[model samples]
Every structure is written in structure tokens, then in C-alpha cells.
Target: MKSSFFSILQRIGHAFMLPIALLPVAGLLLGIGASFTNATTIDSYGLQPLLGDGTILHALLTVMKSAGSVVFSNLPILFAVGVAMGMANKEKQVAAIAGAVGFFAMHATISAMLELNGLLAPDALPEGSLGMSVGINSLQMGVFGGVLVGLGVAALHNRFYRIELPTTFSFFGGTRFVPIITALSYMFIGILMFYIWPSLQEGIMHLGALVNRTGYAGTFIYGFIERALIPFGLHHVFYIPFWQTALGGSEIIDGISVSGAQNIFFAELASPNTQQFSVEATRFMAGKFPFYLFGIPGAALAIYHCARPEQRKLVLGLLLSATLTAVLTGITEPIEFSFLFAAPVLYVLHCVLAGLSFMLCHLFDVGVGQTFSGSLIDFILFGVLQGNPKTHWINAILIGIPLFPVYYFSFRFLILRFNFKTPGREDEGQETKLYTRQDVNAAKAQAQKGDQVSNLIVAGLGGSSNISHVDCCATRLRITVINENLVDDEMLKSSGARGVIRRGTGIQVIYGPHVTLIKSNLDDCLHNAV
Candidate 1:
């Protein structure tokens, strides 16, 4: 049961990575375009005023804004494709195509159901229904709807993909059967969703209201739970709805409606009335900036200073890159994972302190937004670029003053008093060797081709007979084998894996962002080998 739960949670996390990876570029485009096009920013930064209307730079900025906005606008389709690919064990293309068909069919079916129920409208549904806008005879189900359609297709595709058909129906035996099965299943789902979604939407609205009413206390809880759930890989399920659904926060800007706190903030920032919205509406994102930019790096310093003197040298490089990752990109897994396995209690303390920081930021009305992590990059683009009148950027410094020391000293005191392993103090038998990006790249170069890398990875994973399933997330190759004992960790490392993780029959080979290509190559190699 534990293994099954872990497997499911891991797959969800893997699915999230696909959409998550695209956010940084989108965010950058939005930030740059917003800053350049804003009259205030352009004037303050001394951009050419005469070039503003119909000029090349203005046209370019318009393109930039459209590029950024389109990603969020069409997020539903992206989620559908991402989730389908993430969940598929084989023939990712089949699952993705089926997921697309299922998405449209489900929305159409839901539209028909709602029309029959007399609840449908042209531009909006009755209150307590999903969708940002209404269309002819139907409303868009948004990202939440996309998630359901994707999961449905994946389930159907996985179960029936290999089923044998009678000779007369052999042409539709394999991948061809996936979309047919998915579309049929989703018709039933559409009917069910039409009835269930209203209440579900109402519940989500009430929950959002409760959180909003709680104010800073709500921010604290959100920040704490978001970090706390990372170990179990369930944080995305908790936050994405709040980030994308109407329940999170929504606003109609410049004759267009945008949902989610982040989306609303960006829309407002790009519009002339960036300062018009309530700062409190941005409470979700505001709380995270201080913790990511100040508190996490301090925690890293504490861990490093307390490490065994001899081993400190060994961990210094790890600590540096991990600290930079946390501060710049808001990616804290490297830093958090460093201490989580070594000192679980300390991890909880970290979460609690993070929660406190969130509350403090909200209490001070520090508003900021991020597409990815709450890193320095977002702090500058979202908070600083928009100027202090809107986001209260200086309040981050105020919150960070006490917040940083609290994380640093608390971590230090606990590590020393309890003699926690932290990182450098681990037992001799535990795997202490760390691999860097350079190491992975070198491994890749040594192999020269993806096939060679895949071959080595396959050999390391105990080859075709041993591997039961193969899949990948953003940065890791998720594989399951009949027997874990047959896997060779050294061979995997040499084959370009930065690290190897094992949980029962499940194994994940870490290879950073290039993992998708490696997974594709590995799939091909496995096919040819068989």
C-alpha cells in the first residue's frame, strides 16, 4: 500500500513538471514586456517615448506580452497533454492524442448536459461553476477540467493498449483503440461532472473565502503546508488549483478576465492600472518571496557551518550551488533534500519557520508574484519592476531581517543540541558521494550518443528482462524493475545519471532537465533490444 501510494504521488509530481518547466520563459516574457510597456516604468527607465506608439520596440513588446499571456490562456490543453504523457507507460504519443480528443469531447458533453439542465449561458455559467468564460452552448472547464480529461485518457490507454482484438478488428487493436475508449468514458464523466462540478466549485469558493478571511494566518498555513507536503510530493495537488482556479483569486482586466493570483497580478502589472488592485489579493505570492530569497539561504549557511570540519570541504560545493538555486530560482529541493533524510525533525522546523515568514510578509502587506519559485528573479521582475507604490517591495527587507536569523539560529541550535547528522556528519556506510552537472555532462560526452547513454542506463537498470516499466519526470527517469537487486548503481552513474534513487521495485535515475530526451532514447533502446 505504501509503495502504491508513493508511485501514484510520484507520477502526479512528474506530470506537474512538464507545465512547470514552461513557466520560467513565459514569466520572463511577461516581466520584460510589462516593464517596457508601462508608462511609469518606461518614463522612469528613460525609454524612448516617441517610439512608443506603433514603433518596432512597441510591436516587439506586444509580441512579448502575447507570448506570455497565451501560455496561461491555453493552459488547459498544455495540462492535458502534459498529464497524459506523464502517466503513460508506453506510446506517449497515443496517450497525448487521446487526451486531446477526450478533452474536447468532455467539454462538449458537459456543455450538452448543462444545456439540458438549463444552467448554460453564453459568457458565464450560473454562479458556482468552473470556467473563466462561457462559449456557445458550453463553458470552458479550465485547467481543472483538463486534469480530469488527461487522467481519464491515461487510465484507459494504459489498460487497453495491449489488448488483443479479433482478426476482423485487428487494425484497431493497439494504440488505435485508446481515443475511442477514452472518448466513450469521458461522455459518462462529462455527465457526472456537470452535476458534481457546481457543488465542487462552491466548496472551492468557500475554502478560498475562508483562507482569505484568515488573512496572514491563512498565508502562514499555505506556506507551511506547501513546504511540508514536498517530501510526499503532494504539494502540487494542493496549490495548482489555488493558483489557476477562480477560487484562488480572479479579476477582469482591460475587458478580459484572468483567474489565479499570479495571472491577475501579471495582467494588472501589464495594464496601465497596475496599482488599482488590492495588495491583499496578492497574499498568496507575497508571503513566499522573503522565505525563498532570505530564509532558505540562511538555513543553507547553518547547515554548512555545522557540518563536520573535514567533510565540510566535501559539502561546500554542494551547499554553494544549492544555496544559489534556492535564492535565484526558488528551487529548494536540493537544499531541503540535503537535510531531510539526514534530519527529519529539522525539516519540520524549516517548514514552521517558513510559515512564520509568510505570515509576517502578509502582515506587512508585501506583495509579489512568481511563475516558478519565489526567488530573487521574481522579486526583481514582479515587485521591483512595478515599483513600490503597487507591491510594497521594501517590506520584504523588513520581514527578512528577523526571518533570516530565526531560520539560521534555529537550525544551528537544533543541529548542535540534538547532534543531527545534517549532511557532512552522516554515517560511514551511507552514500556520501555527490555528482554535479559537470559530471553528468561528462558522462553524456563520453557516450557521445543518446543510444549509448540509454544502453548504459538499461544495463545499469538490469536490462529488458528486469525492467517492468519505464517513464520519466522533468529531471529523473522513473523505472520499475522485477528485482531491484539486479540494478547496478555504478553503471548508471557512469552512464550520465547524477544519482540513483530506489524505493522497493521503483528506481529513479537523476539526469537533470535533459531527462526527457534520455527517456525517449531509453524507450527506443529497450524496444530494439527486445
Candidate 2:
């Protein structure tokens, strides 16, 4: 029972990646365009002649900003399609289409109910109580509504995609029945949400208020749990609500009330009337920048310095690459998993420091926002470019610079004192590299030939017969197997996984940020094998 629940949680978390993946480009376009078009920014930089109101540069930037804003604006529907497609066990494309169908049907039903209740008028409902969802005047359920539709539709899709029916209804028995059932089911759900969501919304608002009232401690706990869940691959599930819904707090941006931390930050970014960005909305995000940009690299440096002298040269390149990945893109598992399995004490310390970073940033009122990761790209686009007056981004710098040595010294002490077998200190003859590379060339060669890496992974997973599900998150290939005992951890490691995490039926093979490619190859491999 525990395994099944863990498997479901992993699946839902993986499902979130489909929509969350779209944020980077959208954020880039929005950040650059908003930065250039802002009157304050233009005048501050004295580039009026080149990028003034009527200039081509200004006009183009305006278009760019709008393009980015549209994605954020439509995230609910995107989540609907993404989650359904990600969660469906079969007929994924059909499930995706059904997700959209259900989303529209649900909102349309709620809109009808609101109009019937005379609650659709401009003043009929309290401000921010009734808002739009894909142009439907509906209750403000936010991304939660999209998620509800997606999960419900995917459940329906999985149950009925292969279902048989009476001869008279046989035409709609299989995949066709998915969308038909989804639309009808969500109509009832919409009616249910229409009646109950108001109270739920009130409760959510109170929860957000309570979270806000917790202030520094709240931010620390948020950051702490986010880092703590990394090993479990459930951090996305933990943070998505704060990033996308009322749980992160809400504010009126450009006369439109925007909920969620990222939403408020972006809306404020696009608004010309904005002065300083909202620190409250950004507390959930600013904390990541410091740790990702500085602390992780510091820890990497400590690992390198602690390596055996004879093995230092051999491990330097690997450590540098891992640190660079974390610093530039905010993907830390490569560096993290290196010591996570070897020296869990350091990981615990890292999580504690990460929490402190969040608390400090919140205390300083740093307002830096991020799209996906706290990479230098996001830092420059959303923080540096937005100006310190708005983001107080320099505060993150001030907080982070000192954290560097703290991480280095703390990690160094822990490694030496505990004699933690971190990278180079491994027993002689064992590879000193973090996350093994012994099979990289072989894995690449196999991938180029026919993705035999997938075959090895399949064998490692005890063949397709024992496997129940296969999915992935940002940096790990998540799977579920019937018999965990049959799984070979060493085989998966040799197939290029940095590490393997096993909990009953659930397995997560860490493969860094490019796990998506691995997942794609495995999908093809599985198809051919079947």
C-alpha cells in the first residue's frame, strides 16, 4: 500500500514537469522585453533614442513581453493538458486532448452556474472572487481547477481507455469514450466546485495569510522542505502550489488581482506602474538564487579540495562540470547526488543552510523571482536586469557571497572529520568520479546504435514484465516495478545513472537534466521491445 502511494505521488510529480518545462523561454522573453520596455529602465539606462516608446526596439520588446505574459496567463489550461498527458498509463495523446476538453467543459459549466445564480456580473461577486478562466466567467479556482480536471480525466482515461461496451455503443468504447466521459464528469465536478470552492478559497486565503504571518520562519521551512524533498523527487509537488496558486499570496497587478508568487512577480514585471517588486511574492523564489548560484559551487570546491592528491586531477573535471551545471542552470542533483549517498551528513547541513538562505533573503526583503531554476540566466534576466531598486537583487549577492566560504569550510570540516568517502577518498580501485562515468562511452555508443542503454535499463529493471510504470522528472527517470528484489542497482549504475533510489516498488534513477532524452530513448526502446 505504501509503495503504491509513493508510486502515485511520483507519477503526479512527474506529470507536473510537462507544463513546468515551458517556463524558461516564456520567462526569458518576458524578462528581456519587460526590462527593455519599462520607462524607468529605459530612462535609467539613457537609451531613449534607441528604445523609446515609438522606436522599433520598444515595439518589438512590447510584443515579446506580451508573448511571454500569454503563457503565464494560460497556465491553468496548460497544466490540464500536461498533467493528463503525463499521468495517463496508455493512450496519452487521447488523454491530453480529453484533458483540454474537460477543462473547457468544466469552466463552461461553472460559468453557466454563476450566471444562473446572478453571480457573473462585474459587481455581483466580491473583487477577486469571480475571475476568468479561458474567457469563461467562473469561480476563481486557479491552477487547482486545472489540476482537478487533469487528474480526474487521466483517472477516467486510464480506467476506460481499453474498456469494452455494448455493441450499440462499441464505437465509443475505447479512447473515444475517454473524452466523452471526461466532459460529462467535469460538468458535474464544475457544479460541485461552484458550490464548494468559495469556502475553499476563503480557507486558502487564510492559509496564505497564515504562511505570510509566519514570515521568516515560514520562508525557512519552505526552503528546507524543498531541499529535503530533493532526494525523494517530490520537491515539485511541495513547491508548485506556492509558485502557482493563492498559497503563495496574491496581489493586484495593473488593476488585475494576480495569485501565486511567480504570477505576481511576472505581472509586476510587465506593468509600467510598478516600482519595487513585491518581496512577499518573491520570498519563495529569491532564496534559491543564493544557494544555487553560490553555495553549491562552494560545496563542489570543498569536494575537489578534499579529494586524494593522486586522484584530484582525475576528479577535477567531473567536479567542475557538476558545479558549472548547478551554477549556470540550477540543476544540482549531479553535484548533490555525488555526496548524498556517500555523505548524508553534508546533505543535511546543506538543507539547513538552504533554509537559512531563504530566511535571510526574506528578512532582507529581496524580491528576485525565477521561472524554473535559480540559474544565472534567471538571475540576470529577472534580477540584475530588473534593477536593484526593484528586486534588491544585490541583497541576494550580499547574502550569497558569504555563504560560499561557509559551505566550503563547513563541507570541508564534515568530510575530513567524518572521513566521508566523498569523491576521491573512495577505496582504491573504485572509480573516484561522482555519479559514475564508466559506462558513458558504452551508453552513448549504444544510444547511437539502437538505444541498447534502454535494453540494459530494462534488464536492470528486471525486464518489462516486472515494470508497471515509467516516467521522469527534471533530473531523474522514475519507475515502478512489481518486484524490487529483482532490480539490479549496479546494472542501472553501469547504464549511466548517477545514482539509484529504491523505495519498495518505486525507483528513481538520477541522470541529471538530460534525463528527458534518456526517457525518450527508453520509451522507444520499450515500444520496440514490446
By TM-score, who's the top model here? 2
Q: Count clashing residue pairs in model 1.
A: 0
lDDT of 2 by residue, 131-169 (tens): 688998788778888898889999999999998999999
Model 1, 1-530: lDDT tens digits are: 56555666677767877776788899889887877787777777777664376779988987897799778667777888788877887888999999888887777887788777666554356433445422424454567777877777888889999988999999989999998888888888878887787777667668778888887788889889988976655677777877777667656677665666766776776688766434556676777887777888788889889988888887788788777877887767767767776688989998888788778877877777778878888899888877887788889878887777888999999989989887777777654434356645654574465557878888898888998888776457877787889999999987755567777677777765457667777777888888
Supply candidate 1's per-residue lDDT for 336.
Answer: 75
**Model 2, 7: alpha-carbon shift in Å?**
0.6
Off by over 4 Å in 1: 48-51, 114-137, 254-257, 276-281, 308-314, 426-435, 445-466, 472-529
Best by lDDT: 2
lDDT of each structure?
0.76, 0.90
Give TM per candidate.
Answer: 0.85, 0.97
Candidate 1: give the clashing pairs: none
TM-score of 2: 0.97
Error of 2 at 394 (Å): 0.8
